[model samples]
Target: MTKKTQPKSGSEIFVPLNMLKKSPHNVRKTGHTAAEIEGLAASIAANGMLQNLVVEPERDGEGRETGHYFVTIGEGRRLAQLLRVKRRQIKKTDLIRCVLDTEHDAHEISLAENVIRLSMHPADEFDAFALLHNEKGMAADDIAARFGVTPAVVKQRLKLAAVSPALMALYREGGMSLEQVMAFTLTNDHARQQEVWQGLGWDKGADAIRRALTEGQVDADDRRARFVGPDAYLAAGGVITRDLFDDENGGYFADPGLLDRLVLSRLEQEAQAVRAEGWAWVMVTPEFDFRATSAMRRVYPSEPELSAKAQRRMEKQEAEYRELETVADNEPMTEAMKARVDRLEAEMEALRGQPVYGPADIAAGGAFVSLGYDGGVRVERGFIRKEDEAPAAQRREREPEPSEGREGSAALPERLVAQLTAQRTAALREAVASRPDIAFIAVVHAFVASTFYFGNRVSCLDVTVRTVYLSGHAAGIDESPQGRACSDRQAELAKLLPAEVEDLWDALLGFTQEQLMRLLAHCAALTFDAVVRPGSTSSPPLKHAEALSQAVSLDMAAHWQPTAANHLGRVTKAAIVEAVREGVSEEAAAQLADLKKPAMAEAAERLLADKGWLPQVLRLTQKASARMLAA
Candidate 1:
């Protein structure tokens, strides 16, 4: 119009770097974060700029060419280049490729570019990562550097891409989820993955998918696998399936048979060493149950006595620890003093539980060898099988007078022993009621006994301290830490208890004061019938149980945690969301609200894993129930 031919819309042009200004018409109001700028800079540095900046000519107020441009869509890229220029890596006059637009509204053009963009689907990312590694021969570290992610993340994505292609198709089609895809990457067995996929109908979750794929496999962390170290098992031709997504996963041994053989081989070797100690006989089993020896008798080895010097040291340490504890309660002590107290306590623990049985007991009794939770060999001594029992007259001399109305002294039937223990438990309760401190200690002892060991009755006490066997209602309860502890203690005690009720009196007299207190606690613990009934949860006994829980500072979190199998999966989707909201945060709950129940449960378990959360009933305070109900 003014003797100058106007440039056509959608024209291509080259703009100088220093001449490009951030467009005032940009739709994005929030400025890019420093991390975003740094990442963008890295991407450009590694591989030169890939996207074109949308820009228009900047006109002076006099309507004259200003030799400048306004960058519309790629302001982030413009900044990244400026950063390169500041580092003297590029000149300010470097030409940038840009699309010049004039016809469309500037703001509308920017908004359209920002709004129409779609993020690359995670499935595409997985495949892309795999292609770079497989076709281009790029390592995980190289790919991660280009993408600004951890090498572990790149490996995880590469593994994800290796999942059954059919399953990946399903993931792309929205028929499956990212989590399900990740779970399928646990193994590269395409046939098994497809088999599991077909068998699973709907509402499938990562945990269920993983379980199906790993069926018949033992976790590398399993006691059996641990007993036979992973390297040893692998050397025996065992295969392992590992999860790339789980950094902490120890992996699953695909051949459990091989692992079992190795465990047995190792245990037998340990048994050989134990047999050299001169036992009547040594038996090796994968697991030894004290319950299996209820028909047997256990003879004691004369208790070991501490040497004079050791006894003096022990007493001095105990006194010092008590004094430090006293001062700690009244006022804070110096760090050095507190540390000294800790050292003394540790020394006492090291000295306190030395093996009570002696060489003579080993000769008279056989030992059972098995694996402990940590995969260490456990040798349980002092069991007298019926065939190994002493001569009748000698055994009779070992046992003294029978309780009133009880006849047999040696090898009385189990039913009679039970009756005698019941009677003695009643007498012990009456005795404990008059001695409140002993009663409280007995109760505490009952719980501690779960962590420690010893439980049986030659009528000293058949401490069948059953506290509401929740195993039926809560599957895998027996496998829980607290549950296993209690079960193991009960079995060990059964092996040690005298088979004859007539020997009960002499056995009780030999029991240490601590041992007697344990028996008393066992008796008291058995009487606790405070299990919540269908409609009687608020009964008087439960109140007393609550009081006792508070007194003992019973923190259930240490004993149990919510797992997909134990708590979350059994509850409703709404309940899972609420638990996440309460145990974590509202935002976290919102993230899970859209997930299906099974997936939500697994997600909730991960979220609450280390949070140390518990339900109202598990809380020590009785008021917790009221507060939860009100909420």
Candidate 2:
């Protein structure tokens, strides 16, 4: 029978480095590279092996003790020591202190030592690094070198450590995730951090926290900021907050009031430059809406003559361009020909720079200079304010009074004049209804006169187009597709008409029947009123407008749809649900009914999109007969 050997208890002992062999049953499957081993060797050489290697005494089949030991733990340290011995830094007979055991399972001990050793938590590591920075007076680069990390990584860790103490406590207590903790580092306001943390529930995520923190602040990427530039804003003593953990495009400006002031100051400076050009007045703003200059009269700028030198240069470039074109048409195209052609075109463009306005016209007109959407300066010249226009009575005194008409309109009293105009309007309507061609011409003339002459006496027709201003605001009213289409068409037609009012009749005679019909439709569209007046129902006018829309087959869905920015965000939760229920399916509305107002609005916007739905104000009436009855 085999006899059992007595187990030996663990004890600290000094073993020769050459006698310690790495165990095959080591838990670690990968070993360090040559460079890493070198680094460790240098560390061990300087620190004298701070940790002890765990080893087991080698045994024979007869249960007898051997002089050699098998390393169960610190296999990496063994390799590093071997490297030092090969470099002749340590002798082969040098002794390494180790824990010796004779009975313990080497595999079990190795596994426990590797798998159970806990790494320091990232939060604790961040705090430690911050301490090294603040207490030791070490810079980021120095800390990074000591810790074997990049300077940027050290900076990021320090930023995380700079978060509010309350939030850091929450993180340490396992109440907040690492991402949530990182988001709180965007701002240095301790109260705000606590408020956001207390206000948010589990459903709100890091993005929500970031948005809440950045509320009322402008993004650095905004056009206004881009126009004024960060340099200028910083020069004006503006403070900007940064997000070190997340890539939010340079973060946001903390002081929006300062940003606004800087923008205004820049705009005012630009306005001052424009004011020196002899204008009657110069208006400046960061942005101007469509309604800003809607009621103002616009004057046209006259083209300026070119200088003698510029004219000669332009003529020479033109001649060169023609010669290149002739050569290209006759011979095979070459790079030299292309180059010459491009040069001539560039020269011509340089000669055709912005036109210079005359002093006389500049004195009589004004301009609007503002920051454009693309961060460039936009200048709109030759706008005459209403108060600056010449009085009409002053010029009329030089002309003779018109003779009395068949109704003797001039001699009539004010009330009688109104009565006579009422009768004449009825007669005119009947006459226009009888002749479609004349009606088309009359509407076109009236519209053209109003557009070009600013409602002056440019048309023979006496019909006046009615205007209704809504008391309540509607989203995208001025920027709707229909409005933009009409504006574009008007601009196109304006380019074709004569500058003088007296030549309008001759220009009208030149239009084809199709052109006249298009012009008439546009003019007719301008006369329709769908505004809801204050303290009064707009049912009659709206009903009439619906009829006109239906006759023209207006597609409101093509023009507009509900969006969070335009519609849903502006209304209450109940209104949003109702809109979804009417426009989309009731099931969709029910699904969104339980959400908060902002969340419900966002969901409704998504659900209603591409559904071909419109609000009541935008929808056209069914037919002309239905609309006429309502009217």
Q: All candidates: CA RMSD in angstroms?
A: 11.0, 10.1
User: What does candidate 2's lDDT look like per residue over 466-529, in tens digits?
Assistant: 4332212663343344544655675556555655555677788789998877766666666666
Weakest 10 consecutive residues of candidate 1 by summed lDDT: 451-460
Positional deviation of residue 284's Cα in model 2 after best superposition, in angstroms: 2.5
C-alpha TM-scores of all predictions: 0.55, 0.61
After superposition, the stretches of candidate 2 with alpha carbons farther than 4 Å from their true spots are 1-121, 147-150, 164-178, 201-203, 245-249, 289-295, 302-359, 391-442, 466-495, 508-529, 532-570, 576-631
Candidate 1 on 533-617: residue-level lDDT in tens? 5766487788888877766666787777888778898888888888889999998888886666766777788789988888766
lDDT, candidate 1, equals: 0.74
Which residue pairs show backbone clashes in model 1? 455-493
**What's the C-alpha lDDT at position 109 in model 1?**
87
